[model samples]
Target chain A: MRITELFNDGQFVVTAEVGPPKGIDCSHVVKEAKEYLSGIHAVNVTDNQSSVMRMGSLPVCVAMKNAGLTPILQLTCRDRNRIALQSELLGAAMLGIDNILCLTGDHTRMGDHPGAKPVFDLDSVSLLHTVSQLEKGVDLAGNELVGEAPKFAKGAVVSPCSDSVDAQLAKMERKVMAGAEYFQTQAVFDSEKFISFMEKAKQFGKPVQLGVIIPKSAGMCKFMNNNVAGVHVPQHMIDALAADKERAKAGITSVEIAAQIIKECRPYCQGLHIMALGWEDKVPELIKLAGL
Target chain B: MLITELKSKEILDSLTQGKVFIINCHGCKEVSFPEKEAEEFEKALGDKVTGILTTDYVCNIDNLPLRLEKHAAAIEAADTVLVLSCGVGVQTVAEHLPGKRVCAACDTYALPGHQGVTPLEHECDQCGQCYLNITGGTCPITACSKSLVNGQCGGAKNGMCEVDPTMECGWERIMRKLKQVDRLDVLKCPIQLRQYNK
Candidate 1:
């Protein structure tokens, strides 16, 4: 079923994110998507995530769709301007890739090619409005479409960890007004904070999927705590994993933490967005452990 | 108001290999002015400084030209014109003294409020879309690192910013203030996406 339909049916939707490979090969992604097909509602294909150069998200979503899995094409404004973004959206829709997640991607300075020029001509909010305009069979310049307009299940990313909760709420409302049907949040490690965010999001009357990233190792947990923005790794969770000397045990402990968050956040959020973070093969195990 | 810190002597020495004229700004002292640093610049530069000119308000575009013209002879004699003021003051000097090797000696920080005076504890990015009325005068644009206008990012561990541990989460302050003012219904209004151009 389409992701939107799953939301409408009140089904607990589960989506997982996968970054495309650095090259054109899709065999690994196909394998991952195949594993995700049974347990998750949709697979969100990430754009050149973290400003790192990767295979484009569009073809990967197409590959996933061909593999009998619903694919949500994640688009960012870091690399494209309004014209290119509009054209790509139309192309993706024409190719039957319906679900699109709009994000204001990380600045290029954070990526592999630090010298690369950033094209932030439109942010995620602007992209959503442009997509809504396209859905009306018109372009941003008020130009009419030659044929049928593309129907899109628009989605956006939110971070409930923001210091400014009201500003975050205000931006969320704007995205909904601009045509975002659902929101997939940043990785959430705290349940109480997620519950409070949901109380405010519930007023928006839209589906929000709590983002969960499985920590692979104690070092990884510490790294995320130090580097990643809008990610909070509690001391106890890190300590629990740090106590495990072996890598295998550490991985299991991380999965257990994800399971705990899933169990706790399930009541407040309509969905769970598991970001495998290169541990795609382990997502099913995490899902099973969470009893989703 | 902009806060400026004088460039390191190593950088200044590298930039100005020859004689240079210094122009200091005594503008907007209510916020901050580089008084001690300018005094040290004179002492450090010694004979390298051909001349020094101080303007009451270098940011005053109208009166600045006449003030700078008064030092035209000394400025023309020097090989380079080094400005020890905020970016605005530097630009004003550069605008008046065209065709000169003009460079800044200070790094200007982001301005706080409308007059650019008083570096505020709380800032507004002036993203062209203001939600202050609903947010109880708090601006999410500057308070939140991600500039989220909807809800918190859920990364805060204990009422602090996930990105910066020492900082309070912008949303937490907003929520508390909203409750205090009893204006929680503002969250119900479906704010339209920012028209950035507007």
Candidate 2:
């Protein structure tokens, strides 16, 4: 099923992101995608996330589909402008891709291939507007499409923990205004703050997908605290993980803590996007334990 | 994966400066199934796994000093290193850094990254065998193109694969790519899969 169907067809559905390979290798990406086998509702195939040079996202999603998995193709504005973006959207629709997550991609300078050029003609908002037109049976150029336009359940992302939450919310407002059906968040660490933010977002009239990350270790938590953007890992959680000398000793407890957080926040958000990063295997157990 | 999360500070302690170390895969790095399957292994050994940093160029002999300078502290302190580079790099790191537990983070599929939706599938194993001279350069393990091991089953369709739309179906992609690159007649004989066991 398409990711859009799950959003409307169920009370809450679980999804996760999978980064594409740097070459002609599906085994690793497919293997990483297996984390969704037991319970994850869908998977989001990242399109060259972090501006890193990797395989394209559309074919990767098709690979997942061939494996009988529902994949949400992540489309970034950093790579294509109105023409390419619209054409790709048409191709994806024809190819049976179900869900889409649009964003302004990372700056080209940030990737491993620093010398590569970037195409950021239209930002995420403009892309959404263009996609909305595709759904309306009209090409982006104001010309009528001969064939029927596809029914894509559009989704966008917001870093709720942005330094300026107000500004982030303002951008989110524009996306919604552009007809974004749902919204996912960047990795969220502090649940209390998310709850507070949700109190304000409830009026938006769309389902919110909360992003959950499984820190590989306590130091990983510290790393995210120190470096990752729009994410805030509570100190108490860090202290709890750090208290254990061995990570294995604290494994169950940490996942339990994560599951518990999901439970607490379950009522506030529509679903969770578990980003285990390199730890995709445990997502099934985590979701199962949470009864999500 | 920016260090975005850790910076979300509350009232008490303010987050200061932070950094993330990334390995440049140069042109040799590729991610495969082993890396995907290895996640379960990491989960089984939870909290023990740090992020696997893959580099195509930096983890080599030429750049060893720079790599050591950047991660010597982390390497010395940790029990295992999750390498996201190719299998050769992982094995090389293992050999260079004895007494340290190092494992492969990516599956080491192939050297190409610019094509297909599922472009991360296992294509080339780098066994030092060139079968493209016979059956075209498409990999059966990675593309699973037509599932026709020795030759085309006539099931492939117009450039795009039949089984998986994401992949080029090694054979089909190879036929087209070779034709494009002016090497269409490379298939002088039938491909024998057994000689390239690895």
The candidates' DockQ values read 0.16, 0.01
TM-score of 1: 0.66
Worst 10 residues of 2 chain A by lDDT: A162-171
Candidate 1 residue-wise lDDT, A1-292, digit = tens = 4588899999888999888898879888788679654567899999998889999999998998988888999999889988899999989988899999998777676779988987766777778889999999999879998899988889998888654556567768878877899999989998888899899889889999999998877788888876676677888888888887575454788888899999999989899898988777778888899988
lDDT of candidate 2 at residue B58, scale 0 to 100: 34
**Which runs in model 2 stand beyond 4 Å of their true positions?**
A35-38, A248-250, B1-198
Q: Estimate each model's TM-score.
A: 0.66, 0.58
Number of the top candidate by lDDT?
1
* Model 2 Cα lDDT, one tens digit per residue, A54-148: 89999998888887788888998667767798889888988999689887666565578767766655667667777888898997678887778
DockQ of 1: 0.16
Model 2 has an lDDT value of 0.61
